[model samples]
Target: MSVTLEKVDLSLKYTAYYKQVKEELFEGSSDILNAQRSKAFQSFVMQGIPTRKNENYKYTNLHPSFSPEFSFAHSKTEKEADLQEIFRCDVPQLNTTLAFVYNGWFSRKSSAIDQLPKGVILDSLESISKQQPELLSRYASLADPEEDPMVAMNTAFAKDGFFVYVPKGVVLENAIQIINLMEGSSDMFTTQRNYIYVEEGAKLQLLLCDHSENQNNYLSNSVTEVFVGSNAELEFYMLQNQHNKATNIHSVFVEQQRDSRVTTHTASLHGGLIRNNLKFILDGENCEANMYGMSFLDKKQHVDNFTQVIHAKPHCVSNQLYKNVLDEQSTGAFAGRIHVVRDAQKTNAFQRNNNLLLTDEATMQTKPQLIIDADDVKCSHGATVGQIDEEALFYLRARGLDEGKARLIMMNAFAHEVIQEIKLEPLRERIDELVDKRLKGELARCHDCSYGKDC
Candidate 1:
């Protein structure tokens, strides 16, 4: 027999939690930042947890999964192990700079940066605030919390995350890597806020990973803001592989300027309940933006991908492609919106979502929306949900391949299109390996799990 959880008043719980946190944790923070936090908290109290009535959250519900009793702050008494041995890149040949965020705080002691150039700045957000207050003042809390409740919660509680800045006309020779490892010794609720800025004529490649060291039930809320100036380029890749008991909500907002190029790739390999919100605003002429995502979910896991691209200037282009593969009783959702303003006459936008159901009980919901106010725009959107083609599977089986092998080949081909968009070779190969393992149902736990012996 299973026990059902009774829903608690999340708003009231957060109100009490926020009051204690403000008085205990934020007493000595800068006045400007504290004011921003206060306004964001108020917005959160007014909006509350987004319900099914909210169109953006119509298919996903949080009340059933949220735990009001979890502690909101990290415990100082919790001891940490050797981070280097616990969290390392899967790619052996990848030579990149490294940074670590331990339990929602940027860990300077565990992070490594080799020969960072003159104009590039990579440090903790809290440290950067003390050293370069002007930079934080310019971009912190720039996103409107009233629009999204999760963003509001992150803003109100976010104290430390990553701060990255690339000055004009500088291209880093090596890629930057960020490893966010959650050391959950108890049931924990954590929030992290990140900021990134790329000036004109610059280029950057970033790889981010989310992993866990234990199987504790936890909730992680994260937000990132990125700005790309004129003639700049940014390639971003996000890989999520956490314990099955963890719940994650990640939001990314990007603003692009004239003649800039940005491509973002997200691979949700594993999670219990994962929601990813990605938005790109083409705010200048002749800019280009590309978004790609792939999710492999099985068992009782659920993954939601929400994306929006707004063409606010003329002669801008945007493209999006997302795919999901569900097995057993898993669930998935995709809601993508593209908007073109009236003055943006020469806009080109396209969106696509595809799903493959491997079991009768697996479910998928897809919605692609286009709102165009410009007369001279080319926009199209489509969604498809289907199973494996029997004929193709039969053809492969007839060629000396087993049934499972044939299905794996077909599914790998189906997802390779999105994987090909990743520019970094080492990271791409590593993701390919992981995705293959995921499809074979061999990846039951994270590589760095501390309790693997229990299995």
Candidate 2:
């Protein structure tokens, strides 16, 4: 299953493929999306694939993941089964406004969203561009294609993604859930570019679930851009559970205005190779941002999470926490950076990363950074990578528990700090149940076709 592309193949092969599919890529696309394809392709050509030589990607090697030749997903495939009936969140007491994305294209079922609020827009990016182009005017404004090749590649190849816009002074009590499903009969690649906008004094909660079916080899590059206006609040959460043959590059950029607040949580349960890039720019006074992430890995999985927060204005606060648990020969990494501009006074930033290695071969690397140019800012960061506490395990064993149970209890306790921070009660409980099952060597039920409790 391991494939390698030589240096020439890695560079020229992708370049040639892009040219071969030039017409398909631009067919039925919005002017906003097609206008930047040329420049974005040029940037991708210059940057190429990232490797360990890059300081930010020093731990994870992505070249081999790209070696596999895959057919790109230009449009939605024929639906064999109803996605809603085949897949459901199955969380008790969890009510949500649900939507589905088949491969990289938003499903037609989702386009007919019902029971919506007034002045709220949630629809396909391509449809919105054609119907109301002004809604997506802020697309790609926060993400920089020139800096990261993955972003550039998505910018160049992505035709459409989901879009959401909330009018000023409106608050939606129900949470919006978007399930992104990747299923195919052969190896394939997908790209999705989502844009979200919340006007002043509006509130919204969004949840994204990523799942794969049929065990096909899938590689997806998804980018999301969010803007929180003055006096607005937004809560975002992502759950990733897929087969081991999947690779994902998830990027998110958030920009907050004055007196706005944003909180995001990400849980990585299973995947072959996962890379998460999250950045926040606090562009106004009295803005706050909080981010939390956790990963559970086994087998030959590899996960890397990189984050950055820029405090560009005074009186802004930011906090970040990420934890990982690795078993077997799995490996993971975390790199978090916080930056305070020279003129941003009275800023407070904090970051922490912790990891637990369950086996001798398991590996973890953590780096926490803080760059403070303001004289009156307060900043701090810390990281730790080690095994679980033997004393705690022994104590649990002495209380008539077996070794495996004792270890599981300790690991669960360590991860509870981040899980308890989730604001959704049903989601928090479901994740707890899923984590317990994952620790017990059983995957969760969203994509497990058996429909049995054990996968």
Candidate 3:
């Protein structure tokens, strides 16, 4: 009875809060963004936060994560800070155009805005929407807010997030890195709505890093929409490292045009109750989309990764690979769905989910689904969940290495396939080092973002 009461209260609380703050939520938001709020709020009221009853979220229970008392108002009003000096990337020779989003708002002190190529734009959604309202409105809701309650809630509450635009034929030389840092004195909730558009013949590489300055029980819901124009190429990477008191929810929607290519890598180093929703739509023929993800979880941490790939055009190709290493009492889940429509003949899609359990207490659930209306398409999916291969471990121990070293070696070899898929040389090396430290039962350091500059 208490559980049911808590669930009902959570829904009613947020709904009443929205009704009270509806006017304030529109104060500084873009007109386009505000125009969607009423409908989005209605959807959120209809669908509340997804529970285990939802097929897409069957393995993860989100009640405790959302039951906490969190303030939706921003308590700090500081305009800018020396964020670079505070959260510097320690990987030597890893140069990137850097931007920062402090407490869900794009910082005014980013150095990358001016360094970007001519005709490239990197600014906040509200700021850019005033100038490019048509562009933002066209692609902002590509993922469809009505389909996902989380998307609806973010659409209702989001006021600002970064907007990235690469003009037609323009190519970015340096990868653009956006660091989202959450810091506050009280338990808080944050939302971000971001958009990325790469025009025809353009090329872009983007890195997003999520980190929390302190463990203040932060909850953040973010949504990003991307459009890859014909003949364009995009490489996107995400590094999530936060304290165990934080809850991070991220949903990304990407649409690819003819002959466009996209590759994404997500490394979940640490977090508490992290959920990632990725949807890719191959809208044009000959388009290619690839996704790779790896996570190392320990303690009571929970991570859920859900993906949907829609092969809407003929002759499109898609691939997905996800792996997780769980230890202690940690739990994880992965649900990958591939949809091929009737007109999507000659489509090719493959997906695999593999997990390793270091302790008996660790648990993982994987579901791979294929819904096809075209009988001519080639699609396959597989999932595996188990402990380390005893034979491989024994063979390594027989090679004269200590037991600890041998176990670490096997874990590294198990994760090598996905690590090698990273095309960014320096980033790959850094990720390799982080994973090595994690397997060794030491702090991964995560690009030293949490430590002071000296470390």
Going through the candidates in order, what is the number of backbone clashes in each? Answer: 0, 0, 0
Candidates in order have lDDT scores of 0.83, 0.86, 0.86
Candidate 2 structure quality by residue, lDDT tens digits, 344-445:
999999898999999999999888888889999889888988898999889999999999999999889878999998998998998999988888887665
TM-score for all models, in order of appearance: 0.95, 0.96, 0.96
How far residue 87's Cα lies from its native spot in candidate 3, in Å, is 1.5
Q: What is the lDDT of residue 229 in candidate 3?
A: 95
TM-score of 3: 0.96
lDDT of 1 by residue, 362-419 (tens): 9999999899999999998999999999999999999999999999999998899999
- Model 3 stretches with alpha carbons more than 4 Å out: 73-76, 449-455
RMSD of 2: 2.3
Ranked by TM-score from best down, the candidates are 3, 2, 1
The TM-score between candidate 1 and the true structure equals 0.95
| Alpha carbon deviation, residue 120, candidate 2 (Å) | 1.3
Off by over 4 Å in 2: 1-5, 78-80, 110-112, 446-455
